[model samples]
Target: MTAFTSHFAFEFRTGIRNKNLLLMNYLFPLGLYVMMSLIMPGINPLFQATIIPSMITFGILASTLLGLPDPLVQAREAGIFRSYKINGVPALNILLIPALSTILHILVVATIITITAPIFFDAPLPVNLPVFALIVVGTAVALSGLGILIGVISPNARLTVLYSQVIFLPSMIIGGVMLPYSMLPPVAAKVALLLPSTYAMNAFNSLAMGGTADFYAWGGLLTLFVGGLTAFILAWYLFRWDSQNTGSRRHPVLALLAFVPYATWLLIV
Candidate 1:
């Protein structure tokens, strides 16, 4: 317990101390929130109604996708994980601590957006606050697992960026963050199902914000929970303490299994 607390505390502080993590965790998300708050409401006056959830979703993507993977890649490259293993730290702790800290940072940013959205921009609050919080935490856990999976499978920093962007950029454009899911073209809508942000937005709109879901809201939430569990399990199985020990783990392509829940949800839901 003492070791766990120490690791968690260090990772939490690292979220702030690392400049890129700090940017994704706080600056980029908040900046976009402010920018969107000032500019988006003018372009689409209805934007304020959903700004809180949308921007909060954006913060999660930036922090978990953009910020989380590179550090783990770097740490592994630097042999930090190898040292930890020699010193008796578990692989689960090595991954879980950083993910928890990142989630905490994301929630802090989410809280800021939630509180200030109404006061500063007249954004409508979630009618069901408890459920809204549930979805946020659910999305965080799901994405944090994805982040860890990326870190586990990606061999280098460059590939990590490529992997993260493959999800992040599309989410911003078509995952119901910048625009409503209903407004997307039919083909794009089908593609959007692959992204976690789409389910998040769908659940937030229907289950919490008192709006319609593009699909079954409860099923969407379940997809996130199941998807997160799958990703975390895969990441745990794939984790290596150092570059020298990659022979026994599953193929990196196996990481694609993380999307099984989302794809299955698309078919059944």
Candidate 2:
């Protein structure tokens, strides 16, 4: 536990020191909101009400999926993970540091969005704050698990970059961040439902639009719990702490199975 805490603190501080990462993890979502608000002036209220939550979700995705994975891949490639293993650090603890950092960053981003969004858009406060908080926390957990999976499995930095885009871009669009699922084509809407982001957006939209909060809230929670658990298990099996020594022990079967979530989304659509 001490090692985990120490490592988490070290990584957290390192993350804070990196100016570009700091801006991307914390401020980029808000910046996107500002840009969207300006571009859609007439729908400023909608942007504030709906888009803020979506952006919050996006922020969580970016921090975990985008920010954490590349570092882990690089660390593995450079033998940093081996050094930690030699020092008696548990494998889970090694991964936990970056995961915790990403979660903390997501919380900070969500809090900033919650506080600032209402002022700009005059959006109604969440009727069930506890439920809303749960959904946010759950979404972060799910995304972080996915991020860890990506970080562990990606063979190189270039592959991590490619996979990050492959995972995030379509998820963002179909996840209903840029537009409401209702406005999408039927196939697209069905596809969106399979992604964790879709449930997150539903939960957010419910809070913002005063719909059946219970449905979206519970839906988001379930998706987060189930999806995150499955991804974490797969990641644990496939992750190579010493990739250099593994010497071409590739698992194409596991790689294909990793796409099940996306494939499930297509089937639903």
Best model per lDDT: 1
- Report the lDDT tens digits of candidate 1 across residue range 133-232: 9899889988898999999999999999999999999999999999999999988988889899999999999999999878898888988889988998
lDDT of each: 0.91, 0.72
Q: Residues 81-139, candidate 2: write the lDDT tens digits.
A: 88988888778876777777878878888888777777875555666677778778878
Q: Number of clashing pairs, model 2?
A: 0
Q: Candidate 2 at residue 146, lDDT?
A: 81
Clash pairs detected, candidate 1: none
TM-score of each: 0.98, 0.87
